[model samples]
Target: MGELVARSLIALLFVLNGAATARDPEPRRAKAAWFGNPPLLAVRANGAAMVVLGLLLVTGWQRTWVASGLGVLLVLTTIGGHAFWRAADRAERGRELTQLVKNTAVLGGLLLLAMP
Candidate 1:
């Protein structure tokens, strides 16, 4: 039951993320601080990677390896996108901090799913 719920959540996250990227003309620039200054190709690649990772998680294929990879990618993304910027203002910084926490939680959840 819990596994089912987790898979559903992960799938939902992927769908929403994919939709957001598809809808936005300049996704990289739109969330520049959060996503880093990725080249267009890199941004597209990352999006594609996320979709594949999400699918793997949902399908429970090589569960541990896939989840670990996703966790690593999320960690790197959080550090590169949010931590690196260190917004000047309190409000902006707070938002970034919140995003960091959210990303960390997602990573943790993925790790837990990967565990035996």
Candidate 2:
């Protein structure tokens, strides 16, 4: 029951995130710069993929694979989007640190979803 709830909530989170990223990509574009700043189009594509994958996850198709892959993505973006060590503003640094920790927690939840 908790697993089902977690899966649903995580899917909803991805849905909202993907939609926001697709709609307002500037924020994501800025953070994604660390990895050579791929084209904005690529970022948009990633958001779209997330939406699709999130839908698949909600339906329980390949749950373990999807959860694991999403967990990996969460880890990567947690680093990419919130490397507090590189932040200039103290508040920004703290915010980023919080985001990183929150992402880590979500990643743990995803890992749980991956388990049988």
Candidate 3:
């Protein structure tokens, strides 16, 4: 079904992104530095949470609760990682803005999934 496919894709996104961050976290660390020097462990924690939440979402167990948790996670990551306004390079700024918008839209989809 289309819903399953959508959920699968979203879950894949979370898993892949999380894996990348967990493995090579310098990029994420740089982004966090834009606000302040956040600890590397925090980035690892995000990665771990994303993978777990994404897997739960794909399984469709307690769908509403999983979706709500993922939605909140996405929003927090967007605020922490995608502060486009703080980007000095124009191209980097543009990229961050795009990612911010994309994540925000995904947050909406997660909220929709959260509905009973």
Candidate 4:
């Protein structure tokens, strides 16, 4: 029961975030401009993958594969979105660093879930 609840909560975060990204790639596009301005299609594709994998995770289907996929997706996202070192201002750097740490924890959780 606890595992199910944890999976559900985590899945919900990814699913909702993915849906939002898929629905509006423009914001992500602008934010990721430093990363060479990934195309809207690419952004949407990533989001779609997240949604599909997150759903699979919560459904207890192919848990290992889904968790691995999500972990990869999260790594990419953290690199592109939470590049704290790139922040020019102190406050901005702090904010980005916080995000990076949060994502790192989430990634750790996903990795644990991936194991048999």
Estimate, for each residue in 1-116, the C-alpha lDDT of model 3 and write its tens digit: 88777778888889889888888777888777866677898888888788898998898888899889888878877888999998889999999999999998888888888999
Total clashing pairs for each candidate:
0, 0, 0, 0
Overall lDDT per candidate, in order of appearance: 0.71, 0.80, 0.86, 0.88
Assess candidate 2 and give its TM-score to the true structure.
0.90
Model 3 bad stretches (over 4 Å): none
Model 1 agreement with the true structure over 1-116: per-residue lDDT tens digits: 78978876975676567445544526454465454466665655665677788887888888888788777767765676676356888889888899888887887788788897
Instruction: Name the best candidate (by lDDT).
Output: 4
Question: For this target, which candidate reaches the highest TM-score against the unseen true structure?
Answer: 4
Rank the models by TM-score, top first: 4, 3, 2, 1
Q: Across residues 17-75, which tens digit of lDDT does each residue of candidate 2 receive?
A: 98787787778989868866867787777677678777877888899999887877677
Q: Tell me the lDDT of model 3 at 38.
A: 75
Clashing pairs in 2: none
Judge candidate 4 against the unseen true structure and give its global Cα lDDT, from 0 to 1: 0.88
Model 4's TM-score against the true structure: 0.94
Predicted structure 3, TM vs. truth: 0.91
The clash tally of candidate 4 reads 0
Query: Which scores greater on TM-score, model 2 or model 4?
Result: 4
